[model samples]
Target chain A: MTTYNLALIGFGGVNRALAELIRDEPQRFSSLGFELRVVAITDLAFGSLVQGDGIDLAAVLAMPRGSSFDGLPGGSSDPRNEEVIKNSPADIVVEATFTSPVDGEPAVSHVRWAIESGKHVVTTNKGPVALQGTSLSKLAAGNGVRFEYEGAVMSGTPVIRLAHKMLGGLELNAVQGILNGTSNYVLGRMEAGLRLDEAIAEAQNLGYAEADPTADIGGSDVRLKVAILANELLGATIHPSDVHTTGIQDITSDDVAQALANGLRWKLIGEARRESDGRIVASVQPIALEADHPLAGISGATNAVSFTTDLLGAVTVSGPGAGRVETAYALISDIIAVDDFVKGAVRA
Target chain B: MTTYNLALIGFGGVNRALAELIRDEPQRFSSLGFELRVVAITDLAFGSLVQGDGIDLAAVLAMPRGSSFDGLPGGSSDPRNEEVIKNSPADIVVEATFTSPVDGEPAVSHVRWAIESGKHVVTTNKGPVALQGTSLSKLAAGNGVRFEYEGAVMSGTPVIRLAHKMLGGLELNAVQGILNGTSNYVLGRMEAGLRLDEAIAEAQNLGYAEADPTADIGGSDVRLKVAILANELLGATIHPSDVHTTGIQDITSDDVAQALANGLRWKLIGEARRESDGRIVASVQPIALEADHPLAGISGATNAVSFTTDLLGAVTVSGPGAGRVETAYALISDIIAVDDFVKGAVRA
Candidate 1:
């Protein structure tokens, strides 16, 4: 069996969930003929740790909350992320740091360093991908490694893979979708007669929205997702800032009620389309859609993306947009993709 | 650039459409570092052609109706499909023959012949997959060749790829959706106040239903598709005859109107579920789904498959179920997959 060493750049919810999954599902990974072990973990709050052999995932998860990596046996305190990327015996680096849509900072540099160090990269951080995905893709290709970000847009929904693999040869013209689950859940509540603020409060209570929910409610999250889609699918270099975004924060309960009465429902839609001249136009806004529209029936916190293509008309895919376990699944899936790529290269 | 030689076992509407697409999109295929050439084409009615270099797809398309393959410069009149499979210099065989739900004759033997000859197989025929897919999969695995049937169910819609690739590690419990476009179209028309007979006639007029629409109307087509899904996805060895099927032919216009009045729509749903006791239950029947149901919104000749999974809840995929170009795209996509497999093997 092949063994892959992993370095996690952020010890956030997704990373912890992945640790738990790996600890719980050894048989699953073994059946696929691969063994994964974390060699290093770096986080802003929890600090960093590096071990040449492997870290005990279950033991790491059992550590008390707010404990630093130094507290673990045979570990050091707060090693720099760059040190882990440059020095760790890792085959893949997974970055799950908080996203920065404005500028793909630290995450972008971290991804680049990992690729340069000859390590495959898997990330849930949308910032780097939305802003510099195409560039990073080129860098990874240059280094003969993989840079996968399936969780960036729709958690573990697999929209990117669907477009790239399933719809491989089809020429897609447009992509319209509900990419933000928090905003979708809030809007669904507003349609059920709750005020916007009340809906937001409900979403926060259910852990669907962040404590500081501006990113989702302001449509910035979806803007970033659209930017990533445009860059990856349409071969267009687009930034989140390039999109004209309108958030759900300004949408009142009355607007939703009125739309419902008029045979439509308000949905926060993230859309990107290719113009006749091949220019890509992307936007994120609250739009009214008839009940029969592809994205209209997507309720609760589910995300859906519809790809309009020349040969196959329109194809839509919908699923859960986010969850700790769901996002963790994306990382695992990417790891498998990296393994496939490595195997293919070796076989080639 | 790599080159792939393809042989068509059935030169029906889908195969002809594929030839036309290849002729129209030469640059698209060439840009992907691949050149596809039709080396041989064998059909019972249209005779057979063999060109070791490459058949002129455009010239063949331009030929008169009912012309024999001998009319071409370097072709023979009616070489048997077996001869083509054994003697032709083909990397992949495209099988789009008529499907038989009862016993997968002809197509099953054709697929076996191709696989035994160490050739990759891509089929739009459902019969062999539903009946002998498990055996064929093992055979192909032994030969290190790909046996892809993306066009067998849902035309070119990408349901199988979505499950196999995207939901790579997820535990799927059930799949429910509209698998037959003809039944859906007929039901849609009946819901619009047309009698069952009238709706069937309309579907036939639009070429959505066959002259002998028994397979679609009686739900046998859906049964075959569900059988394929059960065997391929859930690892359940099920036959088409094992499914309990209920046809849409008995649903009257009055029934449709009543269902619509009750916020429901009549649809031909193909369902497969793995039981808690490790048994798999499959059925194809006319079911009245509520308006908000995931499968309810799919109208007309559209097909949708919603996979109920444990990790990400329900993931739904929808697209056009059948058409000349749509199914043709499936064949082309499968060809690419086969090429990837062959290339991977070579590299390995």
Candidate 2:
């Protein structure tokens, strides 16, 4: 039995939820033929905590918002993310830091440090994967470690792995997804006659949108995911900027009502398809979809990705796109993948 | 590079479509790091043909429906199903025989013979997998071979594989699905103001329903799939008859219209859930689902399975329920699994 020691790079909602799952459910990991032990945790707000033995996850999770991991065993108020990621005795590095769409920041560095340290990495951040996936993948391969990021796309709904592993032997032609929950919820509200600002405020109240809702509404979020999909699934080497992006910010109530009258529903669709000439064309735009379309009925904050394949036509998977435990489950599935790889390696 | 010699038990529309795929898409198999060669075939209509070398699939596929393989090399006018399955030099057997809801005869025997002969089996027949799945699985495992039947339910849509593989580490509590395309189509037609008989006749005209349409309308087809899901997914040892089934034959157009009036859609649903006491409860019934339900918007012959998981709330997969190339793709997917197993065994 292999018990993987993990170092969580961020103590945010997702990692905290992972700690919660470990603290709460014992059989969840053991039933999968392995166990997980968190030995190190580093966060910007809560600082760094490292115990060669397992950390008291429940206690750390119960810490108040302003509390820091100072004065405990090997604890410090400074978040030494680099030191903990590189030197910690961790077999797997769980990176749940915030997604920096611009530079693929410190999270990318954290991932690089862990891979360079010869540790398997599982991340829910979109920045590092969408921006520097190829390089990081090569580095992990050279170091004989895994770099998995299933949560980068549709939270815990299993989009990338479903396309890569399940859709094997079939030619996947294209993928269209409602990748963002906030924008989808806002559009559904618009269809229900709410104004754009009012819908955004409602989404904020529902904790679906950020304070600045620009990334969610302006298509940048979906663009990053499109880049990730194009690069990972379609083998495209283009950046996120290559995608022709147009979000739902300009879709008005009149447009929504007119679409409803014509038996259509306006949706912010992020689509990537390989053209006949082998060029991958990706875009994020608002389109009025027919009621019979696979994505038309994805209601509320739910997210869905529809894959167009040669054999099965349109296959869609829909689930919660973002949540604390949901995205944490993404990390868990990635670890499941990591365990599979580790077992295969042992067998080989 | 490995090439799998195949014995096609049924040269029906599905197997013939698979032959066409092998004949046309040469890159389809090669891209997946393997090759498929049909060396033997047995059909009730076209008789039996066996060639130690690769059989000319194009020639066999081009033959007329009434033509028998009497004059070809190693051809017989009679379908030597058991002989071909047990004695053919086939590394994998592709079974696409008729589904016998009654005792799972002939197909189950074919599967048993193949496994006993130490050959990997990939079947699209629901009989063996749904009815005698546990014993057949034990037989295959005892013989150190693979027995894959992804086509037994939601043909080529990847229901069983998706749930078992991608949703790992999450607690899947229940599965609710629109498993039968014919019944769902009839229900949709009823929703569009057609009577039950009229809807079934229209479905037959559209090639969605079989000629007799009794099993499709009487809920037996869905009962078989529910049994499969209950046993294979929820680990229940329940038979098809154990499921409390109620088909759409009793649902009137008035019921459909009333459902629509009350913001609902009537659908024939197959559901299997794990009770708190660890008992599996499975049923097939006509359900009026709200528009927001995951299985509600699955339109016109399309099938969907909504997996209720503990972490992600509900994850749903929707796609083609049945088709020639679609069901044929299920065989392809099974072959993919066979190759994986073969490679794993080789490594071991």
Candidate 3:
């Protein structure tokens, strides 16, 4: 059987969920004529693990926190993540580290190293992609590898893939979407007469928002998503900071009521459009959309993107934007796509 | 430049639109590392034209309706379609033949011949795929070729491709959608206080419904679509006639009003759900969807499909279900997909 070795650079909720899915679907990988083996894993908080062959996913899952790999040989409680990447026998690098859109640090360097070293890269880190997609894409292409980040924008919704593969031939003009789920959930609750702070609390209690949900609520997450879309769909080299952004913090019940009065719904939408002069303009703000507009109907924690193109008019794809299983599935899907690409290349 | 020869089986509105798209976008095809050359075209009404090198697309577009291929070398006004399929030096058989779901004849035979003759097939004909997709798929596989019908179910909306390629790994349990634009437009107008007859007439006036709209209004179109989805998604070998179909012709304005009064919208929904015993139960009927349902927001000629999967929850893709450019774009996309597959095989 064909085999692919993986180096997971983060062991957070999303990565752990991916391990669970892999364990549960043995037949799936085998039927696809391959087996996925995680040869190394690295996380800042939980330390690192490495094995030349493959790690026992079940053993790691059963271990106590902080000491999961203490007894295992070649495992360290604090190891440089780059060490795992530089020496691991892996064909794909699965990056799920914390994002820093300010400079796209750590993840950006990791992706460059992976691609330069002849490994395909799949990431959920939005910062690195939004900030460095153009450079990263060029790097990957030069090295004859793939740098896919489908989970970076809309979790597992296939937004970027649809734009690049399915609608690749069309000249896409604009993209409007609800990219941040926490903000949408809060706004949806606010529409039901809840105060913004109360809505935020409810969302936090429901695990839809983090304790410090600044990136999601302050519009930075949507900004990054819009930037990613601009770069991926419009072929624009835009950083997250390049987008003019507005948060949903000022959206009160009065605003929701007024929008409803005008037969509209308030949504935190991320928009990117190609200007007539071949420039991409991107922004993130709350817009009062008519009830019939595609994005207006998207409700709590659901992400949807509508692509306006010359040949196909408007095509929309919607699904869960972010969840453990959802994000993991995106990584899995990317791996599969990379596998197909590599197999095709080898055939050629 | 790499060149791919094409044989058009029907010169209908959709095929003409596809030709126009290919003609209009010279840079698109050239940049993709391939040039498409139409080697032959066969139409029941307008006759046939065959040239191993390339048929003159511009001349055919400028000619009179019935005499499009007249005065051309090796052109016949009453040529058999099979003759072109058998004799043409084509890499792809672009089939837009008239669909006969009763047995998926003619189109089924055409596809079988194309595959057996070692040529790829990209079809917009729904009959063959819905009635005999399993056997046709097997035949194509046996011949080491592709039999793609991305435009069959929802014009060029990427329904089948999304289900098969993008979401292939998920264990999808159910699929529900508004598959027919004619029926949906009529029901949408009926909900706005128009009589059923008036709605149908308005749709006809708008060119959204055929004069003899039996296939669309009678739920047969959606039946075929659901059967195709069942086969493609759930691996259920089912025929359109096996579905319990119900037409929107019987739904009066009063029924729509009642549904609206109950805070629901009337929709001609095609649903397919996999049973516990691995049986797929599919049907096409009018259902009143709750206001917040994913498919509830689709309006006018827009079509939407919601797939329920074990890993990703519900993923929905919606767009123009049937339009000249829309459907034509689907065929082009399928051609591109086939090209990628073929190139990969050559690499192997």
Candidate 4:
């Protein structure tokens, strides 16, 4: 059996979930000539350590949750060690570090190092891709490696490959979606007669909203995603600031009641339409969509992206926008694609 | 410039449309290292002829409308001549001859010869694929060649690939769609308060229905498409006769009006659902669907397929069910996929 050495940049939620999926479907990977060997792991809390060949995933999963690997063979005494980066026998690097939108330096540094080392990188962090997509793409091309971030867009929805590869032949006219799940969940709760603060509090209670929900409610997150999509889809060099954004933070219960009275629903829509002048106009704003419209029916935290093309028309894919397994599925899909590229099963 | 040695088995509507699409987009093929060269033509009315190197597509397009190539450079003196097959140099064979489902001998024979002669085959013929998909698949595999018929299903909607490839990881529970366009158009017209005969006549006049619409209205066409999908999707190994079919031929104006009054629309749906016994129950029948349903909104000559999967939830793709350029797009998409497969860009 063929084996691929893998490095985990962060032992976070999505990385742990991917480890679970790999554990569950060992035979599927084995049949495809894939044996994922986690050779190293790096995290701020746990530091970095290298296991010579690979760590046994089953033993890793058997460890108690939330506990550090203090008993592992490669356990380190220093919290800021970088032995994993210096000595791991890994061929692919999975970067699942935290996102800092103002300055995407941490994720950017890891991605740059991975590309420089000629290792394929699969990431779930949207910060680096949103900040420096074109440069990173060029770097990967020059290094003859892959930089995939499908999980950064719509988790597990196949949005990136759908637009980039499956419908590559056709010219895309527009891409519109209910992109922000946290804001959508809040809006849906408000529509069900709850006040704004109450809905947000309930979302936090349910673990759907972050303790600091400004990134989600302020539309910054959706704006970054739209920027990535626009750059890849329309070939436009658009920064996050270039997108016209209006968060659902301004929408009140009165507006929701008024929309309901007028047979409409309030949805935070992220739309990128190609203008006649060939420049793309992208916006993330709350729209009063009629009941018959497709976007209006997308309720709760579900994410849906509608791709309009010249030849194949409109195809809409909707699913869970974010979850442990769902986002991990997106990351795994990217890994599979990278594996296919390495195996010469698909083009770069 | 790279060139592809190609041959056409028939000069029908789809073949003409394929030629037109290739002529329109010379750059697409040229960039992909393919220069489509139609080296031979075979037709019952125009007889068989051989053009060893390539046919001038521009000159063929300049021919007068409604004029067959009766006296072209490749025209034969004998109507029964098969010189195109006997003498031409073709690397790709497109078999689009009219299908006789009752006796699938001729189409089967042509496909076997094309595979045995070491030429990649792409066909829009439903007879061979529906009746003998297993044998043909095995034969193509044994010969180390491709046998693709994307046009045999939903024309250009990518239903076959969506089922077989895109939703690969998910456990699909059901595959349902509005598979036929002619019956849909007729039913839609009847719902607009026209008699069956009047609606059928209008459909024929509008080019939505055929002059002899038995195959479409009788549901045989939909049965063939469903058979192909079920076999490929569920691994049912089902025959056409095993499918329970009920066409729109018996649905009268009264039934349509009654259905409309009850807030429903009539659609010819082809469905394959898994039973508790691990068997598949496949059927093509006229069903009353509410307007809120995704399939109900698909009207005119449009088709929509909804897949219920264990993962990824429900996804729908709607597009033109059948048209010259649209169906030709499916053929070209298959050709591109085959080209990629042959070049090791995609694995089977």
* Highest-TM-score candidate: 2
Q: What lDDT tens digits, residue by residue, belong to model 3 across residues A1-348?
A: 778999899888899988887777878777666788889888886678889789889988777666655457768887567878877888999999989978888999999889988999999889789888889989999999999899998998888887777786787899999999999999988888899999999999999999998888899889989999988888788778889999998888999988887879999999999888988899999999987787887888999999998887888999999998899989988887788777774223
lDDT of 4 by residue, B112-142 (tens): 7778777777888888988988789889889
**lDDT at residue A76 of model 2 (Cα atoms):** 98
Please tell me the interface RMSD, in Å, for model 2: 3.4
Model 1 chain B poorest ten-residue lDDT run: B339-348
Candidate achieving the largest lDDT:
2
For each candidate in turn, the TM-score is 0.93, 0.97, 0.95, 0.86
Cα lDDT of candidate 4 equals 0.77
What is the full ranking by TM-score, best candidate first?
A: 2, 3, 1, 4
In model 2 chain A, the worst 10-residue window by lDDT is A339-348
Error of 3 at B71 (Å): 4.3
Stretches off by above 4 angstroms in model 4 are: A44-49, A62-66, A77-86, A181-218, A248-267, A287-302, B62-66, B77-87, B99-106, B162-165, B168-173, B182-206, B211-218, B247-268, B274-277, B286-301
What lDDT score goes with residue A197 in model 3? 95
Q: What clash pairs does model 3 have?
A: A347-B347, A347-B348, A348-B347, A348-B348
Query: How good is the docking of model 4, as DockQ?
Result: 0.31
Model 1 lDDT per residue over B1-348, tens place: 888898989888999998887778987677655888899998877688989899988888887777778877657677588989977999999998888777888999999999999999999899999999999999999998899999888899998877987787788899998999999989888877889898889989998899999989999889999998888888899888999999988898889999988979899999999999989999999999986577887877889999998778788999988998999988887887776776663222
- Point out where model 3 deviates above 4 Å: A345-348, B68-71, B345-348
Instruction: Encode model 3's per-residue lDDT on B1-348: one tens digit a residue.
Output: 778899998888888988886677878887766789999898887788999988778877667676746557978887567778877899999998889979988889889888889999999889999988999989998999889999888877778878766885778899999999999899989988999999999999999999999988989999999999988887888888889999898998999999988979989999999999988999999999887788988888889999998889999998889987788888888888787787773223
* TM-scores computed on chain B for all candidates: 0.96, 0.97, 0.96, 0.92
User: Against the correct fold, how does model 4 do in TM-score?
Assistant: 0.86
Ranking by lDDT: 2, 1, 3, 4
With a 3 Å backbone cut-off (N, CA, C), the pairs that clash in candidate 1 are: A347-B347, A347-B348, A348-B347, A348-B348
Scored against the true structure, residue B27 in model 2 reaches a CA lDDT of: 91
